[model samples]
Structure formats: structure tokens, C-alpha cells
Target: MLFAIVSITMLSCGTSRNLDIERGTGYNFQAGHPEYRTTVFGYMDEEEGTLLEIGAKIVKGSLIYKDEDDTLQARISVEYQVQDLDNNNNVIISEQSTEIIKSTDQDISSTRETLDLNYTHPIDPGRYEVVVNVTDLNTNKNITQSIETAIPETQKGEYSLSNVLLDGKIVGEGGWEPISTYDVKSKVDSLRFVFQVISPQTDKRMEINTRLLRYASDTSYTRPMHYSNYSPSSIEYKGLDYDEETELQSNRRVLTDYASTFIEFKFANQERGNYRFEVRAQRDGDEEELFKARDFGVKSKNYPAVRSARELARPLVYLMGEDDHEELMKISNNDSLKKEVDRFWLKNVGNANEARHVIEMYYERVEEANKQFSNFKEGWKTDLGMIYVLFGRPWYTRSHLKELVWFYSYNHSDPEYSYYFNQPKLKNKFFPFYHYLLRRNNYYYTVQYMQRQLWLTGQILTRQI
Candidate 1:
């Protein structure tokens, strides 16, 4: 049965499980693929709040063959979480499975647990304790028992159908950790997609679906498509399988908001050079395609994955802050973004915690947008709000000046703002303010805002008052 979400729903943490069945390590592989191994990361049990939320990023590494290593590799979940597990084993649990979010931002750590898992139940964290159970689907025997962890666990990102190397170049960088790169035919329009299929080294002939796709040239770089196979720019991933049984990446959907799901990425100046990448979803199990091989790396910098844009806004089991973002995207790339984001703020607040006035002020501007320009769109997306956010407030006496002139003094710690008007026959020579005025990424403030600043500093260029 298809578990398609008909609409958007945000399941806040400490809530109820949205699905019917909630047990299984969420190992990524064909339902009955023999070689696939299932591994669980951490265990937890609580007896306090009626809500027990277990959240972390996760990933499915290649299927593990028993006896190859001595690491714990199985996860077990109860069917009716938040509810009391019957003292008698009478609760009928359904077969459990998992899906992988294809187009996820890679994490800084190179591990299989890139995605996070969160479970909120009617049962409080202080109620019945959780016991970890394990069973090898291959051996059909209880192999181990795990103790529930009391504290929250951090998760790594996951990857899917991203292992295959087109001509040895990875088209998709799977899971946040261990970023395996791929090569493509073109750098200009190299479309990237994260598919549901397993690694090419698997014997499972099942076709996996795609969840999202991104265009390298797009402003945000990521395009959201919950789950659909049809596409004008779709590509199929297929290759040789090593017939290994390893747990796959996690594809949990605690919420479905695009802004809440996607991560914001910056180009990490890398030694291996730059390659634009994007992700797209697949149609279904029956759809197929043929791709040619290509080389992806000549001499590249070694960079790993990190958190997505959404994770930064709302933290999971752990609160990842601005400093965390700095480390995650810091990749094997450059240091520009990190320094710039900091300098942008440091110019005003030498110390943030001791001075939170600006942080409060920035959001106030956002709230203004929410109210004033909320017609058919949001204020953040409006021309006025964009400028407001970029430049605090405009200067001088003109809201719509015929022509605006801005000046900056980099060395002397001085900046200036001015406006000029020269219209011979027009009553309003002003070019309808906010016309094509888009936020130019990072800026100190607007012309009017600078004017206000100068007025406060007593550096009015064209005024004596």
C-alpha cells in the first residue's frame, strides 16, 4: 500500500507517531533482499513526560555481513509507541520498513547514521521503559538485546542510489558522512537527484523512487518534490551489485515542509575544484534508463557532508546553532562564508550573548514583513522586506529618490549615503521604488538605513542641520 502524504503536516516533537507500524531499524534495502543487513544506532527509555521523543540524524551504510565486524547492527521498535507495551505479548505488530530522503545535504561526519530518527508517543518519557530487541532476518534468531539510552543521540546524514560511479564519478553524494562523489557529462546542467534504490552492488532488482531534485543554477539550488517519478530531467541509476547485506540509509519524514526539509549549502572552496550538483526523484519501480560512464575527479579536495538548511532553523534531539553550521559547511572547501557571516554581525555586536539587541531587531523587521506585505506572498519574499533585511533603514528624505548614490570608505572606517534628483518634465521621475529591487545576498544596509546611521554619527554629507 502507498503511504503517500496528501498534504503538509508538521508533527512537533513530543507528539504521537504518525504511522501505523513503528518498529524496524529502518534499514534501506528491498523488502526481502537477502544480503541486506539491518543495524540500529542507539537505544532509549524514559518515564517522565507522557511524550518520549527519540530524534537524531541517520544513514544506511552498505549491508554488513555477519562476523565481518563486532559492532551492534540491529534496531527494534514497538508498534504502539506512547502506549503501554502489554505485559503479555499480545500486540499485533505489522511488518516494518524505511524510505530514504534522496536529496539530503551531506553532514560533516562520514558515517552511515546521517539521518535522525524522532519518535513521540502518547506515553510519557517517564512511563514504561524501552528495551532494545534484535533479530537477524537472515538467521531468523534473536541475536542480541540492547539497553535503552536515557540521553538523546546525534545522527549522521544518509544517502541512497548515490553509490554508483558514472565513469567512476559519483553523480550523487550519498548520506551526510563519507561524501562519495560522482561524475557527469556536463558541469553547466548537471542535474542531481537522490533516489530510493539501493547501492548498485545489491542483487535486489527492485526500482527505488526519488524524493527530490535540485538544479545547480537555481537560486536555492534545491527543488522540492515529495515523491513523484515523472520528470523532463529524470535519470535512472543502475549498475553491478556486490550482493552485500548492509542496512541502507534512513528516509524518515517527521514533517513535510520544504523549508523545514532542505538544507542551505555554500560552495566550499575545494582543492578538487568546483562542480555544480542537484538531485531529482524517480517515477516508480518499473521505470528504467541507460547511462554512460564518465570521470568525476582529476584532483579534488576531500570534503564531507553536513546539515541541511531546515536543521539549522529547528534543532532535533540536539540543538545545532550558528557555530554548528559554520563547521558543517566548512567542508574541504573555502573559509569565505564562515568569515563573512560572522563579520556581517561582528561589525555591530562585538559580543552577541552580552548584546542581543540586533538579533531582536532583525526579527522585528521580519514581523513587519509578515504584516505589511503579506498579500499573495510573504514579506521575506517581497522587495521591501528584502531591502529592509539587507539594509536596516534607508537614509535622507526620499522614499523614492530619482537616483540614489552610495559611498563607502573601507580603510578609514567611514561610509556615506546620498540622493540626487534631476527631472525636467516629469512630475514623478522616480522609478517606482522597489521595482526589481532584489536582496543582493549580504549587505550592511540600505541607502536610507545608512543615512540614519550617518545622522546618528553626525556625518551628514549634504546636510548642515
Candidate 2:
């Protein structure tokens, strides 16, 4: 199966003494100056039980450089691992890379380095997790991301489609660089999607139908309280089928056996946000035999500033009680909402500085979510956003092909609390949104505690006072 997982951690700590420095653990935001940010993209082949290809992009501007013989260079140490949670067997990989940056006459410049890391491991088929860690050795800045994946047993002599690969302007030159997540400023006019079909059933004709749509998080239609629809006509691609005799079928490209072929897509003034691309392989009139999807975001160069108090307080909706929530909804204006917000926090936390600290911490997380977790809509509205706003950073996280597991605990030795989120289709269209099964009684307590401690970091607030 094709898997594209982009992992991020939003955590906080109380004091320097309480810092728990794990190889793959770090805060989503820092009170200090900005630091280097890394973006990762990848897919795992479960059938092979090994094919894992990951692509990473590090923006040069985000890094801090040191002077070395008139040359400015930044050194970073990277550690990545894939673990079988069931067996506790993991393959840990680490490396170091240096990027030499050139000083420009101007104060700032745009320079980035892209890395491709590929690995293969043979193991029993089951649930597995992968983690990626990057640290700036110069400043000891660390960032970690992880995901959970499912690898199916590889079948022999079967016609199968490879995972969709995101490419630069060139076709096969950029070896399977998956675009797991991205922003609008990084958008290019021409991009290629490459994959392969192995051991085709030549006797039966097949057609690959592909559709692209932007997610719409506001419009609700289903039982799932958080579920939303996608915007139509924003981004659409209809795949065409061709027979060997015809050579070409309309605008669609024909599938070849064993070799990698690509479909070149052109962009026309697209919006910045999250988009979903789904490809289905089936006989002309038959149901879809193979279903696969890839979710990517068109990020803006800079996030819009949170202007009003209501905007800042919007993230707190998850922490409100039914009565407070009702009162909040009744307020029709941001000015009034601002007063209500101040009173709400002031009531819970009497000290003004302490209340400011709490409000700042919560909104900082909300801003980070908007930067990293945005999909079809704002990041705070997605399922991940809901959990992050309510529960803060997960103690630890696991990545899978179709599911993401988050673990939480008061301390490392305590019984770990877990949350399971999976990718499910709405109206047969695939999206990257994962729905958390927060139905457990324990989770309610966790939520309540997180809400109670909105002003505190690295600790839960059991009661408002």
C-alpha cells in the first residue's frame, strides 16, 4: 500500500528540570527565536514488507549558520527509525549532513536542501511505526515527526499499482519523492505524478480513474460530528484509459507494465490549502479493484495574523463546558467575545500574568496547528486540531500507513493513554483527516484535565482553581 504520513509534535514543558529529552520528542513551538523547520514525505510498501522511501526538505532560511573560513555552514544530525510496536523490533537509522550557505548582499535569501532516504527491511507483516528526528547540532535545536503504517504480505505474480510519487519538474529523475505535506508558496506550475503497474492481467482491460478535490471542513452532512465535505471545481483531474491498440485514450495516459510512467499535471492559479488526489483502478464498468490516495497542502508563504481576541479564543471551544459554550455562542460580536474570553480565563485563573501565560500557551499551539496540520480547511478545525487544542502534545506518537496512534501519560512510568485515528473516506473521496475514537471514559478525564490547566505547561489542570 502507498502511505504518506507527515508527523508533528505539539508539546510543552514546565521547567528546564522537567524536560524529558527523547530522541524523537520536541516542542511544536518555542518561546525563543524561530528555528529551522523540516518537512518530510514518504510511502511504505507493505507487500514488499520493506520498501520505504522518504524525502525531506529543509529551508535554508530557517537554519542558523556559523562562520567557518568565510564560508557559512550549518550542521544537523538526523535520526529515523521504524519499529514494530507488536514485537518491539525496530530499525534505527541516523546520519549527519551539512549545508554550506552563501551570504547574500541582502539580509535574507531563500536557499533549501532536499534529501532522499530509502531503506528496506524484511519482517513479519503487522502494525509498524516510523519516527524521524532532526537536530541542529550548532544550536542543539531538535524537531521530530512520526507515523504508523500497515504492511500487507507481498503477493507474487499479481497486477498491482505502485504508490503515487510526487516529482519536481523532471519525471523519473527525482526517485519517488513523496509530497506528504507542503504549502502554497512552494507550488510550481508543472508537477508530475509517477507510479507503476506490475504483472498486469492482460486479458481483462483496466482503467485508472483519478479525481482531485479540495477538502471543505465547514459544510457538515453526516453522523460523524467532525466530518466535512470538499470544495468542487477547485482542483479536479479525471483519469482516462487507453487500450494497447489505440495507443492513446483522450487526455489520459496509458499504463505500462513493470516500468514507471507519469501523468503530467498543469496548474492554473490554484488556492493555497489541503488537497486530496485519489486513483482507482477497475475494469470499465466494474467496481474499483485498487484504491489509493495522496493528500498534500498548498501552504501560504506566511500565515495570516490572528487579529482579534475572538480569533485567539476560538481554539478554547473544546475546553468549554456546555453552559459556557452556550454563552459563548450567544455572543454575536468579536468585541463582546473578547470580554467574555478575558472573564472566562480570569475566573479560572485569577492572576493576570498567570492568565496571560495560559492564553499565550494555548494560542501558540493553535497557531502551530494552523501552520503544520492544515488540510482542506484551517488546521484548528481538523480532527488533529481538535485533539491538539484539547489535550496538548501527545506523550508519544506512532505512525501507520492508514492510522496514527497517540500515547499519553502523566509520567513515563504510568499507564499510557492511547488514542487511535484512522483515514476514512467521505462520499468515496479520500482525505488525510484522521478521526480519533475519543469514546473512552478515561479520555474524558484527560480532556477535562487539559482544559483545567489551560494556563499551565507540561502539567494538567484538574480543577480551575
Ten contiguous residues with the weakest lDDT in model 2: 236-245
**lDDT for every model?**
0.27, 0.47
Stretches of candidate 1 exceeding 4 Å from the true structure: 1-205, 208-213, 216-385, 390-465
lDDT of 1 by residue, 79-175 (tens): 2222223344333222233432332323312234444344443331221223322333434433222212121222222212211111122336432
Q: Residue 214 error for model 2, in Å?
A: 3.8
Candidate 2: stretches off by over 4 Å: 1-51, 68-71, 84-87, 92-128, 149-154, 168-178, 200-202, 217-269, 272-274, 283-288, 299-465
Q: What's the TM-score of every candidate structure?
A: 0.21, 0.46
Q: Which candidate number maximizes lDDT? A: 2
Among all windows of 10 consecutive residues in model 1, the one with the lowest summed lDDT is 2-11
Per-residue lDDT of candidate 2, residues 142-192 (tens digit): 777665554343355345544454443324444333334433333344444
